[model samples]
Target chain A: MNDLIQTGKYLLIISAIAGLLLAFTEMVTAPRIAENNRLVLEKARREVLPGAERFDTLDLATTDDAGHPATRSLSLGFDAQGKFLGTVQTVSPKGYGGPIDIVLGLKPDGAVSGVKIQSMRETPGLGTKLAEGFLDKFLEVARAGHPVKFFVKKDGGDIDAITAATISSRAFCKGIRDGIKVVQEGQTLIQQRAAAPGATPLPGPATTPVAPSPAPAPAPAPVVPPAPSVPPAPPADPESPPPAPTVAPEPPAPPLPPAIPQGGGQ
Target chain B: MNTKELTKGIWAENPIFVIMLGCCPALAVSTSLANAFGMGIAATFVLLGSNLIISLIRASVPDKIRIPVYIVVIATFVTMIDKFMAAFTPALSASLGIFIPLIVVNCIILGRAEAFANKNTPQDSILDAIGMGLGFTIALAMIAVFREVLGDGKFFGIPVPLIKDDPCLLMIMAPGGFFVFGLLMAWKKHLAAGGAK
Candidate 1:
């Protein structure tokens, strides 16, 4: 009886100490972790909706495909002049392996300006192609105009599948199509938010929105590659070819895509 | 500090190659040099902290409740380090992803607590912790070098000439991790057997 009591005391003491230490660590890291997450979200916003100098998040209560009530949020982007640029939103489409998280930037006309895969669990070397040249092909099809079938060529759509990764390709298309629909639905709300005066400063870099020129094709101005030490300007070459699509490799290794800024940026 | 405790883990009884305690993470993160270093350092921090605490309380921890006590201590350290890394080193945190949280279950840590720190002095335990941590880091780096260079055709993210354009994709996959891990284990065993004499 005495040994049992003693053992109970020992366990209680150890757990209490462990809990206290964890609480202390949480106190210290909570703020910084929050800040880091904000920065990451901001960066993703900029990457998707290039030239978006200010953003307003709109919570949209809508319905899913199953007609269930789903609340979705949209980050409406505006230029330095407070001119509406487009909307950047994230959507998860069911893929072969699992849900494929994709962030998309759309022009005012509902054309896809940029596409980035936030995360996915697809087969490597195959489904992973959604992050490489396949995205470029996707953007081309998107810019071709609305009424896109949003299916693999095999499924009677315009976009080409990543060879054998047809399901992943199909999922990518579905995510874009869904994101575009969200933006279209929330267009009025986005314009209202943009019209509100005294909007907050842009996320990170102070670079003002480039060229308010009226062009249907908003340059997918790649977020200046998060290198503050170097001059923000890229060498002016007429034919450098748009930067290669961010490489998202397969699982078990290099799950990170080069698009992600390394520790230096962090 | 005893030299044997400090040095044995580095080569003679490497946690991965010989003792073979935490091969899951070793193989998963060995796909890239950067990932290997990130995981190694994070695990080392957890190992060092847990070993010290376990050693200090080893005597008082009743044999019946020792395993639970060790787990509480190990988990505390892992969560603390995981939170710190995520807060201060977001890039490394992002790169390592789920592996950091998973360190709570890494056998090398609990293995050391039960096998070495439980009966060892605090001072010797510290030395053992450092040695074993270094062993884990070196072994991970060795695996990462082959996997990244051969599989990805790159070294530390920089493209290697000739290999960069057409790297062997298979090398960066799970089969590749197993292949490199097996070959490296065999080589380590061969060396331990003194050139297979």
Candidate 2:
């Protein structure tokens, strides 16, 4: 009993010292770790929506096709002149191994501006292809046009699936589709917010576009003017100084979608 | 300070090959040269810190409670390294993933604390820690060189000339890690056996 007491005291003293050191280390690194995480999120935002100089956090509240009410938060991107550029939405689609966190960018016209996989736990060499060559292919399709039928070719959709990692490919497609829907849901609010900043009357060439009817028109969805489908110019470098404000100011505030139709039937 | 204590761990009692410590990380993180280097340096830092502290407290630590005390000291060092790396080298920290935290359980650290630091002078223990840490790093780099070049057709992510386009994928997988580890261990043994003379 006496020896056990001694051992306990010894362990207690050692643990106290260990705890103090850990506390000190945590104090020193906590702020830096938080800063690093912010930088990572910032970089991902820029990667997905290149040329976006500033971002405003916005929320999208809607019910999915299955009527499950979901709330998604996104970043509204704007150029230096406060012209609305796009929205960056993050979605976690169910992947083969787990939830794959994907960040997607949608132009004011509802076209996919860019897509990036933020984190995943899929098979290393196989499902992990979602981030490699497959990402480039997906981006190409996104830039090709709006209202992309985001399904794998095997599913009678346009995108090509990674040969052996079809599940991850499917998840990528689902993530893109989900992001578009959320941005569409929040389209009206996004436009209002975008317009409030510049406070400039809509230019004669740029009329308030007819808000898209909130009906579930998955294809040819989002009726904002084609805006010449100006492809989102790839930001030269994500880590470099912000792009020059000389961005050819596209007509600000693409049309707003009409009132969100509650529980629009699938 | 005896130089033999330091030199012996480099080859004579090399941690990874002869003593066979830390093979788990040796195989898991050896998929690339960069990962090996990161893991090696992180583990070495932890080893050096743990060995120094344990050796200093060797006389005062109660015999039965030594393991717990040593663990507390080692864990403190590991957590410090993990936080520091995450803060400063986030990229390396992300690629290495859980392997960084798992270093807390590496047999090498606890093994050295028990075998060398507990019984040796602080000065000698420091040398032993350095020697053993280098041994682990060298062995891991050897396996990583083969795996990355053949499996990924790259060295440190730079494409190797002839093999860059078409490389065998299996060399970077778990089976590949085991295969390379066993082959290297055998080669080391053969070299130790007088090189077929």
Top-scoring candidate (TM-score): 2
> All models: lDDT?
0.71, 0.75
**Per-residue lDDT over B26-138 for candidate 1, one digit per residue giving the tens place of the 0 to 100 score:** 87678777778877887887889989999999999999999999999888878887889889998877655446654766899999999999999999999888889999999
Highest DockQ scorer: 2
DockQ of each: 0.29, 0.34
Question: What is candidate 1's lDDT per residue for A4-102, written digit by digit as tens?
Answer: 999999999999999999999999999999999778878888988888877766565555777565767777677666666777888999997689888
Over 4 Å off, model 2:
A61-72, A89-104, A110-181, A199-266, B87-99
- lDDT for position B59 in model 2: 97
Task: Report the C-alpha displacement of residue A181, candidate 1, in angstroms.
Answer: 3.9
